[model samples]
Target: MNNSLQTMYIEMVEKALDRYVSTQRCNNDHVLEAMRYSVLGGGKRIRALLVLNFNRILGGAANDAMEFAAAIEMMHAYSLIHDDLPCMDDDDLRRGKPSCHVAFGEAVALLAGDALQTLAFETLARNTSLEPAQVLQAVRELAAAAGSRGMVGGQTVDIEGTAQTVEQLTGMCMMKTGALIKCAVRLGCLSVGADEASMAQADIYADAIGLAFQIRDDILDVIGSTEELGKPVGSDAEQQKATFATVLGTERAQSLAEKLTRTALDALKQLNVAEDDPLYEMTVELCSRKK
Candidate 1:
């Protein structure tokens, strides 16, 4: 079931992004190509999957949520593009291919990232299926998550080299990586007009899985090969970044990830879904994912 749902949702996201980007009438072909190169590049599309799956579980139309899901993916792609810039992580590869800046020039890559970020809001705002109020709310949610109060803020701390404790490192990971993830889940619930209680439950589920996802990423950096990660391994160590494995050691990091996965599973159980829910299955897969 998890395999099937993952395949289906990933296909949906790919198709949506392809159609949307292909139909765009851009004045600068190079920047557009850069956008396409970055966004259409391979990824697990987990955030978009979370949106679609949460909407499905909440009785919302997957079709209606498709635009929103694609928008979140675009935002994620934008983040990755910037993250790989020479001034940032300075990586030359992503998803086993040249990073956006490496493929396109630095200027074009910067514009592409900016364009993709604007495209995310544009996609959400232009979706006709959702109400204006809902779109606005989602925009606000994404802005808060991606802006200084969230992902960007965490990144600021990360580059400043100030995370001196395990707690601080955890906080940085939560914001830098978990903010958008949590927002993805919440946006799906909002698309369906879920109540406060339901949204709160979604919050719990997202929070746990989001942090767990980062922990797994950190763990994979230590043990996963470059081919497996689709990027250079040991980048954290190379950059001297603080990570769960660096701060807490391998055994404790793995234990904490397991605990977080358990917390996510407990939240899934509270959703009143069946024991074999796809969301629950996906969460399990996320907790133990090799990539």
Candidate 2:
């Protein structure tokens, strides 16, 4: 996307998130604080941006897609909250700040994560501009992507198979890290009434980019400094977690990421989208992002 369009999209999303956080109230102040801390914590917000960009590319208005984008980010924030729990990754830091569990205690963090997940569904359901069917579809997509068959399942594999083969490692990462991103693109297209063929093409684009995103992340963890990443670097290696870089070597993993980016971009060519479309450009930009 053009710089001006990207700036507008980011500002719109930031405003929506700010308003949503301000409007929320909780019976328990501690839980609410934890929720706000986790949601408002700095991150790239790439998944939400994908939703907005894809909606625009499919001829949907940005205002029409704003609620859905915010919902996606809420769900993502909740996932991170839970993922950092002691039972999961047991992370102490996220985005350069103390993790929810570290800052607010585990019990409050868990409750906050639960609240965010529910709020995501509520956001979509209460959006007046979306058709009932569209809202329902988005909910279904989010549920499937975040449930046992997707992110949760991938985490299970990652925990259970610390010494897995290259293929197994790739499979786990694809589900754990890639599923929500794929859902983001799919839901955006659905919001604008994309045809089956178009959705199928979008799926192809998501699959490639999603995997590439993880591979690049793995590469970055090895080569990038903690200051640059805004979080602890080499944690995956220190934990003996299975990663593309662990199995494929850093050089080979970087090559694979490049290949996947190429495949993702090529998949977009099969669609009838414009060259200057925000979604098309965003896809390319995401693959090229330094962070």
* Top lDDT hit: 1
lDDT of 2 by residue, 50-130 (tens): 888778777789888888888889889999999888898887878988899999999999999999998888887767787
Candidate whose TM-score is highest: 1
TM-score of 1: 0.97
Stretches off by above 4 angstroms in model 2 are: 272-278
Q: Please, what is the whole-model Cα lDDT of each candidate in the order they appear?
A: 0.89, 0.83
The deviation in Å at residue 60 for candidate 2 is 0.9
Give the least accurate 10-residue stretch of model 2, judged by summed lDDT: 282-291
Residue 164 error, candidate 2, Å: 1.7
Mind giving the per-residue lDDT tens digits that candidate 1 earns over 1-291?
A: 347877988998999999887867678899999999999988989999999989988999998888889999999999999999988889888999999999999999999999999999988887889888888999999999999988899889888989868788878988999999999999899899899998988999898999999999988999889888789999899888888988888788989999999988888778886657777777888877877
